[model samples]
Target: MEAVLPIEVEIPSMRVLAETELEEAEWAKQRCEQLNLIDEKRLTALCHGQCYQQRMARAFNARVRHREFKPGDLVLRKVLHITPDSRGKFAYKYDGPFVVKEVFSGGAIILSDMDGTENALPVNVDALKKYYP
Candidate 1:
């Protein structure tokens, strides 16, 4: 005996199964394409990141005015955390009108007190700003 439905009614399970198989095949194809493109995508992302970094560096360098210090130049050193001031948070941000005793090839300088007492440590030029007085 054969199962029968009304002429207007149709079994949807077969169509649904076929549609699901097609959908799965399409998904697998897309996944394979993505896997194949993964390396190229990573390289493109890396190139974009490097380009961004270079652009940022160029913009930064363009705005930067290089500071140069010579021996005998007077400058103020930024107060560091290692050297806490007695005044605490309200303390002055910079430490001296110290004299530049020695200039190094690298951006470092030796500082001296007004009395010409030289500091043993070398300070980065970034930490020192010129003292007008």
Candidate 2:
């Protein structure tokens, strides 16, 4: 009786098969090392991005001037474009020399007309500038 090999082709030498397996193992090891390096690079990039954002924020904050309004101070309120009385190009940018009626902690202030009538809504300090006169 003749013995049958699993494969139809002539059998490869044991030394050749051993060499092929060793080459595959080395390639896999190198690939894993490369993946680790890529992960490290990604983390470094993330850290650099966060530091850049913080620097930009600090520079922006440094240039910003804080506006404060006290009760009884006169300020000019900015006119809204959505107002019914706005003219196309010649409209006045500021509406009033309104008096600050009440000061709120978080930069909100209640405005009053010259006649002592208080506004129903609170306005942000940014929308008003100190009246020189």
Candidate 3:
């Protein structure tokens, strides 16, 4: 039988190496100088950018105004995506041209058919499309 020599393995410690520590220190110094202080001009520019964004958002919202329908008002109800179990599956699609039964805030309108069947459907302000003559 031959004698077998066991091999010894060497492992390094998990601490940060010398070169990596030096590089990290240099990076920290550069970052500290870059963000030392904020000047008045920079602050003013940031504020101006924020204001411009807000104004643009407001203008976009104004273009799509919500139309609230009062009771007895004529409006068209949108056709919804129907499934097999839906009650309106056999009903007329886009069964609008109906009278408004009630009006709610945020542009929601309740409508009733000529046969007195009423549906209170909550819709977004943009969904309430106005039909112009």
Could you say which candidate leads in lDDT? 2
Q: Clashing residue pairs, candidate 2?
A: none
Shift in Å, residue 44, candidate 1: 1.0
* Estimated TM-score for each candidate: 0.70, 0.75, 0.50
lDDT of 2 by residue, 32-130 (tens): 676687789899999999999999999999999988888899999997656676676788889899999999898899999989999999998889999
Candidate rank order under lDDT: 2, 1, 3
User: How many clashing residue pairs, candidate 1?
Assistant: 0
Write the number of the candidate with greater TM-score, choosing between 1 and 3. Answer: 1
Off by over 4 Å in 1: 1-34, 82-85
Position 123, candidate 3: lDDT:
52
lDDT of 1: 0.79
Model 1 lDDT per residue over 50-122, tens place? 9999999999999998999988899999987745436767788899999998898989899999998889999
RMSD in angstroms, all models? 10.3, 11.3, 12.1
- Specify the highest-TM-score model's number: 2
**Backbone clash count for every predicted candidate, in the order shown:** 0, 0, 1
Model 3 TM-score, 2 decimals: 0.50
Give residue 92's lDDT in candidate 2 (0 to 100). Answer: 88
Model 3 CA RMSD to the hidden true structure, in angstroms: 12.1
